[model samples]
Target: MSYDELKSVLVSLGIPEDDISPEASREEVGLDSIAVVELALVLRREKGVDVTEEEIGGTLTVADVAALVGARTPA
Candidate 1:
């Protein structure tokens, strides 16, 4: 999906619109283990996607998370 679409998803996750940049890292934006896991759960429930810590990739920013979600392969 496009970055803009990803940004909206990020915002829905409580991440600010300004924080949805490509330069930010998961940790940089406070994606702690708890939050990450919570997000993974949301992904699963909302999109039927399974995201693992290992599958998080080297994604940095909220935009990166969006890209990751978009990149998720169908089961």
Candidate 2:
């Protein structure tokens, strides 16, 4: 997944578009523990990406999350 695609997913999860950015922290974008789990599920089930909550939780910024997702995503 690209940055824009991850941003879109975050948006779908009820995070404000204005709060999302490459440099934005996950917490700054309202991605708490529950949101992280939901994001993992959404990525796996909806987007066919096999990312885990733990992996998502390890990321600091939105751009980091996007990079992790992109690495795990199928080519």
Candidate 3:
């Protein structure tokens, strides 16, 4: 998964670009628990990545999400 694609997913989930940075946590970005769950679903349904809810909850930042998805994505 490309960074842009991940970023787009974040935007679609209601996170603003200004709030999401490589080092910024989801808490810092104002993405609540509900939004994080929805984001996991989006990544699964749209990007074909199978990310668990636990993993989503454990994610620290936008960059972390991207890395997680990227790792699962087929080359």
* Maximum-TM-score candidate: 2
Report the poorest 10 consecutive residues by lDDT, candidate 1.
1-10
Give the per-residue lDDT digits (tens) of candidate 2, residues 20-70. Answer: 999999999999999999999999999989899999999999999999999
Q: How many angstroms is residue 75 displaced in model 3 relative to the true structure, after the best TM-score fit?
A: 3.2
Q: Per-residue lDDT of 1-75 in model 3, one digit per residue for the tens?
A: 887888888888778888878788879877678887888888888888888778877888878877888898766
Segments in model 1 whose C-alpha atoms lie over 4 Å from true places: 73-75
Lowest lDDT block of 10, candidate 2 = 1-10
> Which pairs, if any, clash in model 3?
none
What is the model-wide C-alpha lDDT for candidate 3?
A: 0.82
The TM-score, computed over Cα atoms with residue i paired to residue i, of candidate 1 is 0.68
Ranking by TM-score: 2, 3, 1
User: In model 1, what lDDT does residue 1 have?
Assistant: 49
Which segments of candidate 3 are over 4 A away from where they belong? none
Better of 2 and 3 by lDDT: 2
How many residue pairs clash (N, CA or C atoms closer than 3 angstroms) in each of the candidate models, in the order given? 1, 0, 0
- Candidate 1 residue lDDT tens string, 1-75: 456765565578787777657778887666777767777777777767666765664566766677677777354
| Model 1: how far residue 64 lies from native, Å | 4.1
